[model samples]
Target: MSPAAGFARTLRAEWTKFRTVRGWVLGTVVAALLVPLLAAVSAAGSHASCDRNGVETACPEPPLGPDGHAVRDKFFFVHRTLDGDGSITVRLTSMSGIITYPPPDHDEIVPGLVPWAKAGVIVKASMEPGSSYAAVMVTGEHGVRMQHDYTGDVAGRPGGAPRWLRLTRAGETLTGYESADGRQWAEVAVVRLPDLPAEVEIGMFAASPGDLTVKQADLGGLIEQMRFTETTAVFDQVKVEGAAPGAWRHTDVSPTPGTNPGEVHHPGSAVESGGTFTVVGNGDIAPVGTDGGMAVELTLTGVLFALVVVVVVAVLFVTAEYRRGLVRVTLAASPRRGRVLAAKALVIGGVVFAAGLAASAVAMPVGKHLLRGNGNHVLPVPALTEVRVIAGVAALLAVSAVLALALGTLFRRSAAAVVTALALILLPHVLATASVLPVELSLWLLRVTPAAAFAVQQSIPEYPQVLDFYVPQGGYYPLPPWAGLGVLCCYAAFALALAVVRLKRRDA
Candidate 1:
């Protein structure tokens, strides 16, 4: 038979084999129906809870304390040293303060700030006050602990002065470290700052209440930088001699009731040891695809599983004929070997392509509806470039199917082909990312890798260093979205072409 005729017959035969099996249809249907329903339902419910009756309730306004002082501001500010360009410095003497508006809930200090106990401030001191102690006034400790003398040193000037005030958080404790030359660190004191059910002002304060002279230093004023160093220090770098008072000062500088306490330079935001949080009062961010910022990240892990299914089916398509050495007989019937491989590729590609598109179409709307009711979804974050992103996702699936077809032809054994294809699609990206490639090379590699193709689906550009143009200003990559997807497409085509070359020259 002519190569064309042989190709036509082989294609028909493979199609027949696929239809005879039911797994593909079943898996596709499951993916299409379930994804949408679950996502929409969860999203809608969240929105309803935030509403009070017919009206959406506003977040409770910040409250005040008794000392005529408005305990603390809702907003917490942390200032570190900056270089000549106004950029923040990573040197020593950096300081960070946590300002809890009203005191947070605590077990210590009665009339404390709780849901009902809403008043006073809770502080844990690292350094002993010139002459004072820290205690729970209205609120007490609720097991919110901090580490003392965490790791890195605070940056300081040449005169052995603090470069910046440093605050570090590890596990339970938050420790403050002071540095003279951004190298050697001195132990300030360590205390469990108040943070719990109720909100409160929890930060550094310098109070000096005496008759000789009155001076309440600004904790922020002394700061040069605020760096969080070691989480769990190994202490491999420590060398101790005898009593070196100049090396470090360990005084119980806890907050004591003062006659004239100094002003808290800058109280920082309350530190919650757990839970995901964005900048408070920052605009609501919705997801991609959806109008609200909730792009339902539906990772169809089933794709990997489906690759297995395809491999199994392909092997069955070819190896089923292998039984009793049927492959030899089949090859004899079609003298042209390349024709046989081409036909198989065509049949597998068509089926997977159609199935993938159908699945995507069905899954999206289903997931949309399931997610619609979840009120927790913020408004969608839309950029003019997002439309290109949508196109890229569709392109990605097409490439996946093409690659799968090549794998089926390359490894006639179903299990082997599936594993090989999965590894090809998954491992390159993993290995590439794991190693340290330079920025330009890394971006280019990501653009060409199969894994990078999938990243186009990320509505929000996730990596500022590689994938985006500007992270702080929310800028996407300099390349247009379509252009980026094109880079991915080039990769897919290259792999497919290479597979075609191998099939033409190699024996089946």
Candidate 2:
């Protein structure tokens, strides 16, 4: 017979044998069903107590984005209109605040402001959530910093020596400077805001991000709450040059409503106090938490666990034949042992692929629905990303199944093959993602191990601009989706090749 014809017959025989083994066939089906069912159960109880009755019940006007993440927009703005081009210079003498803990017994006084408590000079396009703006300020303990666009941060002098800050706007470009004496100025940062309007708000502003605490839920969910605090900063020597403007407007642009119901405290006008004003305000404008604060991806939560079933079934597909002495009869009929091995790998991989694809297709939408029904806000992604996740999952299962089969053929023992597959393919993923090891070692483990295939199912990305935990424990994959999966595919191909070589040389 032709090589192609002989391969076809081997594939048919392998398929018939797989179907006749009720245990293996049933295990595959159970894996497919268990993924979606477990996802549904996990999602059904994933609601936070604050979100149990929807976010509106507890926080009617919560600063939430389209993806239901708490946004950073509210801050106390004590700004004056700068028409055309101008510069705002201020001397920040001191910044202080008092923080409180959770309510009922929330009487603990920290006597210090949060780390990111800001008091500085800012030139903003507007008081919007994602508006273009820049500020040079003194933090509570982090010293001086120049921050802009809700993400970019430039460090200034540490230990809080320099108190003089100056922000100059030249058309679309904004330059920040820091100095101890005002005459000897050191450049802090220079940023250009695209299409910055001719008239903008330029003045001293103060804000505090407050204390944030995270509570772990019983069912693998995180509840995050931020306690708003009153931050006060005293700004003096407030000078506005190169601009023809009216009096400074004391706007209460505090992002956190009801935190400070009073207006911004301006001790005296600059004109009356010899170009010096004391401005007291509170609120913050920083990157929102993109870490565990976001809702979980319920659809893919059970994928790694389902892989256990896939590994066992795949190992059994080849090892069971050897265990029962059925491989001798099969090898007698098809003397081409390599072709028989290839046929078995193809049959098992294709079956697992179809099963995984169907399960993921049903899981994604249903899981999302259950999450929303449980009053959780699911993070939205592009349609192409959703497709990649589903397709990647199916490919991961299929390739891993083939790898297990190759191990089974080489070892010829079901227990040994299954344990080896788990050790090589799943253990590394668990360790890396659980943060059991250091981040560098965890990332290295994923880079070289077959468990890197788990990256294929990662939907979230780590953004440098966002200030959140970007570890694998927080759903951030070390490698790109396709690159990680490719590593697993290479390992599987190498193992299968070795298995074929052994089968060709050894007796059945």
Candidate 3:
């Protein structure tokens, strides 16, 4: 037979053997069903309700930016309408904040600035929250930054307060500039806002994100709390070109409605005296995920259980042959023992990939619907992001199956192979994500182990501008999606190579 035909026959034989086993087929079906089934159970267990003076109220939907993703758009804006293209220049004389419940002593309130605390000149699309905008800003400790549309951030010159920040708008394009003396200028970055209207709001703004304190929970994992904080910025030498002759409007863009603008958490205000403006705000303007709600990936919590099923099936697919002396007979028929391993790997990998893809596809939308019905805000992501996440789930399962199958072939004992496979893949993931150990150790495990492949399920990215608990338990992975998956791919390749070498040399 031709080499290609011979390989095809071997592949078909392996697949036929897999489907004929009643227990294996049942296990695959059970694995596929577990994802959405557990999602339904999870959704049913969660309940959300709000009450104002004993009156029931619906939960608030998460704020979404122009790009149709979750965002936090709360800041103090001292703005006026700019007819068309214009520029806003402001010299930030001082930027300071009050931090409540910061670390070391949770009871004491202190004066400080969070690293991301910023005040700057901005040309925004409107007073509406989540609108597209750009700004040249001075931060608390991150120096100067030019950020736009919630996600775009570019570093400028290194300076805290007393920074000269300028933002120029020309049609849909915005350019940011920083200066030491206001005479010599350096361009920070030029960004385009595709949906910017002819008229826009140009202003000075101040915002501070809450202070997050994290401690280990009594029962493993982390417990995080956001203590309310506020920032005040004083801007002198304020100049706006092409602004309409109207009183500058001040808006406290707050996430909580009916929240007292002067309250400790939402203490937002604006004052102007003799061309100097003072703005106080207690919120953030950046691309945000579902910090207050559950991530969509949470519905796929059943994947871990499904993964255990996958590991068992994959290991048994090969080890059963060895246990029954069928592997020797198969090797006798297919003298190229490497081809036998390749065929088994291909069959098992394809099965798990298909099963995982179907399960994830069903779980995602169904789980999202259930979550929303349960009064939970599921963070919105782009359609392409959803597709990538789904495909990534399948890829992760397939690669994991290949690794398990290779381990089975190497050991030729189902119990030993299954235990070793789970130790290499599942146990590390459970420990790191559950955070049974220290967070630093958890991060190290995800960075170096096969468990890193789970990063593929992360729908939202970590933003430098937003402060949050970025541990594995918080749904944030240390490595990028594709990079993390590649770690598992490497493990599978190495194990499979060893299996191929051993199979060719050993009797079985």
Candidate 4:
């Protein structure tokens, strides 16, 4: 017989052995069942709502940007209609802000800017939230930037006040320029808006996001502190080259009041005197973070619980044969111990992969329904991303099972193999995510340990432009999804290699 046919027969025999054992079959079922069961439990305990005009209401979904993604569109505006091709120019003299209830010294509201605070000039599609727009701004600490459509940001120069900014619109394109003396200008950035309107709102704006501080909580996990903040900008030498030059209008955007917790309406204001403008505004214009909604993965927190059952089943699949002295009989039939080990790995890995995939597929939609029913806001993701998450979860379980089966082969004792496998995978997950240690150490464990594979479930990305508490406990893993999964794959390959050597050199 050909070697390929012989190996295929061995593979089929290994699979047959696994199914004939009722305990293994039942264990796999239980493992798959845990995913949705625990998902339901997690969804049941989760809840959210908003305070609207002294009454509670279901939290509103995040405003979708022109790109159809969730975005934060809360900021003050001093704008006027600009018809056709036009340009708006302004010189910012000073930019400042106030932070309410700052930590450590929580006794006083102090004067400051929280790095991302903005004072700028913008030309927007309309007054509506999350519409298309472009702006050239002087930030609190990030210097000057040209931002558009909530996600596009290009840096221009590095200073605060005494900066001149210009936003010009010609047809569908927008260009930003910056200067120090308001004479010689340097091009900052140019962006072409798809289907830009002939009439748009052009004006000055100010915004500051809440000040955030993260500290270790006494009860466990990181405690994020958010304090109220507002920013003010003084603009002089303001100029507009189109429609009724100085006809500016004041408007406060929605979500300014009667929404969100810890938010008390402080609708921004604008004052105009002798061609100088002072704009004061609170809130931010950027992509919404995890604070906006629970990630789809949060619905699959059950994956970890499911992983425990998979580990045990995989360990016993190999070790049970050794305990009954059946491994020797199988090896005699094959006359190739290495092929026998390979066959067992393939059989167990394939079974766990199918089980995990099925569990995740069912868990995703069902858990989402339960979560939404319980007032949990789920962050929406791209269709491709959703598919990657589901497949990745299955891949994680499969690789993990292969690793346990190899350990079972090496140790020949189910208990020691199970304990070791669990320690390698589960302990790191608990220590890193349970907030039992410092952030630095927790990050290190997740990056290096087998538990790093769990990064597959991270749906929300960490945006550098948006300031928020990012930690493992918040579903923010240190490594990118596939890269972290690679770490575990490397471990499994090394262990399987060691098991092959042991089987070749030692008695079964």
Candidate 5:
């Protein structure tokens, strides 16, 4: 027979063998059904309603991102209007706060501010959540940082005594500086806020990121409660050199009082006490919990669980033939062992890809509908992004199926192949996302292992313009979407090559 004719015959034989197995067919159906079912269940239960002292109330309209998640932008502002380009210089004397945890009913007095707790000088275009702005601030323990919009942070001094901070604005560019004396300064960051108004609010602001406490609701849903804490910053020699208009005005933009009423306490009628002014406030200007709304974009979370079924079926597809001594028949018929293995890989990969694609296409829309039906918000993404996520998921499962089949061929045992496949493709993902390992090690695992394929389904992206948790746990990928998927494809290809070599050399 011709080489092409032999390959065609091998392909036909493998397809017939795969179809003849009822368990493998059922497993594929189960994988397709389970992903959408789990996604719906998860979405339906993840609704977050506002609660005050354990009493559910009307949730005020949450500040949501493109994907529906509660965002933090509310903070106390003590500002003076600057009519033109200029600078504000102040000495941060001290920062201290009280953090109270619930249920445990205990208070931990922090000597300094908490991480993400900020006291700084800000130049804001408006007091909107997603508006453009630049700030030079001191965080709790993370030291001095220059932050802008909401997402970007530039570190300065790591940790030390209070520092003298200055923000100079020229036209559209804003430069932040840290100084020892009021004279000598070290430039920390320079950022440009385009289309800035001729007049902007420039002043001292203090905000403490609300304490996030995770709890289980009665409905088997996850609840994230944000408890507000008061943050105080003592500023001395508060001086602004620009077109200033009169006295400073204080504005408190805290969220509706739930557990704690947010407030801003300014220097008393005594004004500057010995050239020092104090400001105290509650509420956060950082991104808050998504309140289960983020669950919609994470439709792929169910993929990990569904993939186990795929791996088992894939391994059994090859190894069952070995156990029944049917492989000898298959090899004897085709006589080209490499072609036989290739045919099996192709059949398994194609089946998984089609099943996965159908599951994801149904899951995304169904998940979104379930989330909204449960009174939860769903964040919108571009059509292209949605298409990529669905397509990527299908590709991920197909590649993983081939990998499992390759392992089965090499091992000639179903259990070993399934375990090895799981270890290579799933364990690293769990460890990385769970944050059990150090970040460096976790990142390395995703970078080098088949688990990197998970990046293909990641829909949320890191924005330097918004401040939020950017980690694997938060749905951020270590590698670019396609690049990460490419890693898994490479591994699958290598495994198949090895399997072909072993199959050719070993007796069936």
Candidate 6:
């Protein structure tokens, strides 16, 4: 055969060999079907919901302020004080909030607020002395920014002081604390108000402004039960002489990152009783809808498809020998063991490359289409950089294919080779993410692992050490995007070399 003809013959043999294997056919079918199915299921199912059970009602939009230009929306829950005793309880939009406290004189004693963005601790109050003291705690990026002794006029508060509001940027958070007398401190209120132009009011509200009869008495009695215990506090300032000052209830708030901006300012579950217009809070909270499922589903589907491809390729390569007892027959034909091995390597490598190309061509657009229509379709407009990402996926498939071939050659046992390939691909990623190992040490291992090879798809620049999150050690390897992919390609090359060497030395 001519060189081109010889390559064509090898390709033909591979196609014929794989076609006869039922497992290869089934595995490919499953891969093609499963990816789309998972994507569809994710789109249709509930990623998350604003599940406050019953402590509050959604607020409606009010008029925009003089300077406010609809930066974000806020939700609020309101309650009337039928008696001089009531407590308020509620959670953040998604563990996102900045809490401000009043001076002890306001009866906001032992003031506390829980984060509504993610799972976080309830920051209780502590204080020092000054005029109109404030304690602020923020949960997000720049965590607890101003959570110190805040002793100044309420004007010094966040939107200005003395008002002390918690603020957040994306997931970053800041906390500010203030106090007069610098001793006892009272939580004024936790603010979910975004720094953006929009305004939002969420959570429960209650009022205990003391009994109508006690309006003549001290404000302390009216401000006694100013705590959130069961439902969200809708601004209740009532008090009973004997209760624990106020109640504190805990609820899970890691889910609701915020609400759909398109759905804001609708109607009743729309307007606030506080009479303030609701606005969008944080537009930056990620994984839209606060549902962690988008990433989870995507990851699972990709991994499943990759595994199916690997298994099918391994089976195709191994079963060919089983059907013809090719080991013995080929050995007889070649007499010299090395020649038989060379033919197998040439044949299998071609098959794996072709299969990888076919699988990748099918995966990309299909996966993206399956993901469309769901709000999770973040990359609606593809960028030039996306071409690199797509190419990375294809490269990953090709490398995986070649690795599978090498594993099959190394062990000559389909199951054993698949397991080893999986370990090689998955374990290192899990370890790297854990970050338990020192960066230098872990990165060294990452340099060698097939998992790190995929790092080439990373388009973001890695921060250099000293200014970056980590410093590099001597000889420690962490490749840049292209470099990382190169490392992976090198591993695949080395494995292929080993396969060739063994094929030359071993029996069929």
Q: Best candidate, TM-score-wise? A: 3
Better of 2 and 4 by lDDT: 4
What's the TM-score of every candidate structure? Answer: 0.42, 0.72, 0.96, 0.95, 0.77, 0.45
Q: For candidate 3, what is the lDDT?
A: 0.88
lDDT of 1 by residue, 1-508 (tens): 6756767887786577567667654544443333334444444454433334456643221112211111112211111121111111123221211222212322222211111111111122212211111221110112111121111112212231123234443323434444545467654435442321111113322111111111223541111111111000001112211111232221222222111112232111222223211111100001111221444334233343444444455445554554445656666766666566556656755665555555445444455454454433332334433443334444555455556655655565666766665565555444444334333554555555555554554454442111112311122233445565566556546665666676567654
The lDDT ranking, best first, is 3, 4, 5, 2, 6, 1
Candidate 4, residues 150-266, lDDT tens digits: the string is: 888899999889899999999899999999999999999999998578899999999999898777677877778777789999999988888555567898775435463434555
Ten-residue stretch with the least lDDT total in model 2: 263-272
| Evaluation by lDDT, superior candidate among 3 and 5 | 3
Q: Rate the local accuracy (lDDT) of all candidates.
A: 0.36, 0.76, 0.88, 0.87, 0.78, 0.38
Question: Over all chains combined, what TM-score does candidate 3 have?
Answer: 0.96
lDDT for each residue of candidate 5 in 1-508, tens digit (9 for 90 to 100): 8888888888998888888889999999999888899888888787756666678864555464323334566666778877778999999888877666666674443444556678878888765554567899887777888987655678887763377999989999999998767788889999987767878888888887656666655654334555556678888888899947687778765444333443322211113467676777666655443332463457656788879999999999999989999888888888878888889989999999999999999999998887776666665555788899999999999999999999999999999999999999999999988756666787899899999998887765665423344567667778999999999999999999999999988898
Question: Model 2, stretches more than 4 Å misplaced?
Answer: 1-30, 45-70, 82-87, 97-106, 140-144, 154-161, 168-200, 210-231, 241-244, 251-283, 290-293, 324-358, 380-392, 423-505
lDDT tens readout by residue for model 2, 142-253:
8788888765788888755238999998988899999988889999889887757787788877777656665655565445556656567777887888655677776656
lDDT, model 6: 0.38
Model 4 misplacement above 4 A: 243-246, 260-265
Of the two candidates 2 and 3, the one with more favorable TM-score, higher being better, is: 3
RMSD of 6: 17.3
> Which portions of model 5 miss their true places by more than 4 Å?
1-29, 52-55, 61-70, 101-110, 159-161, 195-199, 210-228, 241-244, 255-275, 289-293, 320-336, 377-392, 413-494
Clashes counted in candidate 3 amount to 0
The alpha-carbon RMSD values of the candidates against the true structure, listed in the order shown, are: 19.2, 5.9, 1.8, 1.9, 5.3, 17.3
Total clashing residue pairs per candidate? Answer: 85, 3, 0, 0, 6, 101
lDDT (Cα, 0-100) at 106 in candidate 1: 21
